[model samples]
Target: MTKKAQTPAVQNGNTDPNTLQLHKDPAQTDAAQIAAMALGSVAANAMTARTFAKGTFGTLDVTECVMTLKQRVDTTHDGNLKHAETTLTAQAAALDAIFNEMARRAALNMGEYLEATERYMRLALKAQGQCRATLETLAGIKNPPVIFAKQANIAHGPQQVNNDSFPSSTRIRAHARKRGTTPDELLEGPQHGSTNMDDRAATTPTRGHPAVETLEPIHWPRKPRRKSGGGA
Candidate 1:
């Protein structure tokens, strides 16, 4: 005969100890499942909260480092700008001083130039006066014979001449004809002749004049002349 089949021991129609029976009371099973699920959810939430806190702390550290670096950079930029401004101000002052000195020198030079011009003008006036006096003296001495003739004419014509009357060429010619001479021959005297000394002096060349110096020749050393026998 076959051995009799062993019957499995069952608790509420489930043989596994870990699994609840399907035939168990529904309300009690639901309550137990809900309690287990609530505990699992609470653990999951605690783990998620810890992870979020760690990520937030890391982000805060990064933000703090960025803010610190930005602050340092701002401080350095401000300091550089201040230094540049100071240097610019100093340069402006130095340029102003230089310009003022240039202006002062210009004014001094202008004053000296004006003083020299004034002195030159005074000397020129003095020389001009002396030249005029010398010309007047020469004229007086050289015109003595003409003065005597004019005086003789005035004395002879004292009754006929008015204050504004000038001797006409016809009257001068008649007087020269009565004297048995031509008008030109009577007028021509040694000192008061038609030959002007000023004109003669102007037309005559000066003696013992210095020769003009020629320009120096420009040539490189040891170079052959282009034209050997001609003046440059």
Candidate 2:
């Protein structure tokens, strides 16, 4: 039996930049959202003595409470980092490929030049949007500063995305003396070599960044347009 070769997707005279669509990977986004939910759950459970009350009879342990924060930061920070890196890196690669393809097309016939240039513009805009999204996702990891903040929780801000239900560092410290620990030791960010969630870059607060941009746009080789002439 003879097998036929697949036909090329593009046919002549059907050049349309808008027809090309960007394929986004939902896996990264899905992972990030699920991680967020899990992180949130962990934080909510760690905020109180309810879980510990069963064993300690309502005794508040500062180290124990701080451990909860550590766990929360670790999970959230790590997940956010994974999502950010995967998402941004993928977007950058996609944009780069698109630009190259568009550039190749622009160097061909007249119609293709226009179509490819338009697509190139659209790609730039898409890249910018992705960059902003990347920034937002990274911020969701924890405090944006934590990604690059000074060591020892120097950049550990009091704010959190889903940690409203958790106790404040001040309260945790106030109750620490009762448990033979200091607040600084507890709230000073995740302990090094402690949890798998310790990513120095992910813990820092930072704006979301895009993986692609105008750099991906290819310069079109201008083609000459024929002038109208009257028949003699």
Candidate 3:
């Protein structure tokens, strides 16, 4: 009798320890993949945070880096608004100083050096414009601009269309009726004795000229012609 084939030692329903283990539960495998992805994401975010914080003086660990990455400017926060206001104030002050210096140079060179005065005044004007722009920016930051966009309503239902052959005819008739006149007469417009200036000039007499005068053709005098002959 052949001896019964002996099976290798099985652990957790696996035939061999060296063989790759097949995950029976899809959920477990997915969970492991998700965990790895999460770890990689955290590392990436931490690296980005490190790069962002590189020039800063303070030292930050992974936790601090993650926290910093999570932080964002809160528009509704008072502290953020105050910080922005302070920064704008500082910039405005710096611009004001530049403007004052340029103005002083311009005034100093006014009578003595025309070119220098012009150049300095031009620079001062530029600085003044920048300061004004900065102040305007600060004001905008304090109270943000509100834009009003007019919303147009579209009609989706059945629309009433006017299919009148002559759109103005009805209005003309109604207006003529209100004036107690026929539409044809109203359309003929105001009655005039003469239609145009030429007719009026022909029909009416001028200050010195009589009306209905006939103009005759002008006759120029003919020059006398000599008989052709050989000259002696």
Among all candidates shown, the one with the greatest lDDT:
3
RMSD versus native structure for model 2: 38.5
lDDT of each: 0.49, 0.53, 0.63
Residue 64 of candidate 1: its Cα lDDT? 30
Q: TM-score of the candidate numbered 3? A: 0.35
Error in Å for residue 228 of model 3: 41
**lDDT tens digits by residue: candidate 2, 1-232:** 8754233233433233112122245666856755654466543465454344534443333334445556656866766466445666677667556656655554553465676667666665666566566656655554554456543433467754324466777667758878766755533334454443434434655769856656677899999998779775
Q: Per-residue lDDT tens digits of candidate 3, residues 35-147?
A: 65357655467656555654563333544444333352434243566666777788888888888898899899989998999998888888888888888988998888899
Worst 10 residues of 3 by lDDT: 14-23
| TM-score for each predicted model, relative to the true structure | 0.16, 0.22, 0.35
lDDT for model 3 comes to 0.63
Q: Which is the winner by TM-score between candidate 1 and candidate 2? A: 2
Model 1 Cα lDDT, one tens digit per residue, 138-183: 4454454443334343455436543337777767787888987775
How far residue 216's Cα lies from its native spot in candidate 3, in Å, is 32
Runs in model 3 deviating more than 4 A are 1-79, 154-232
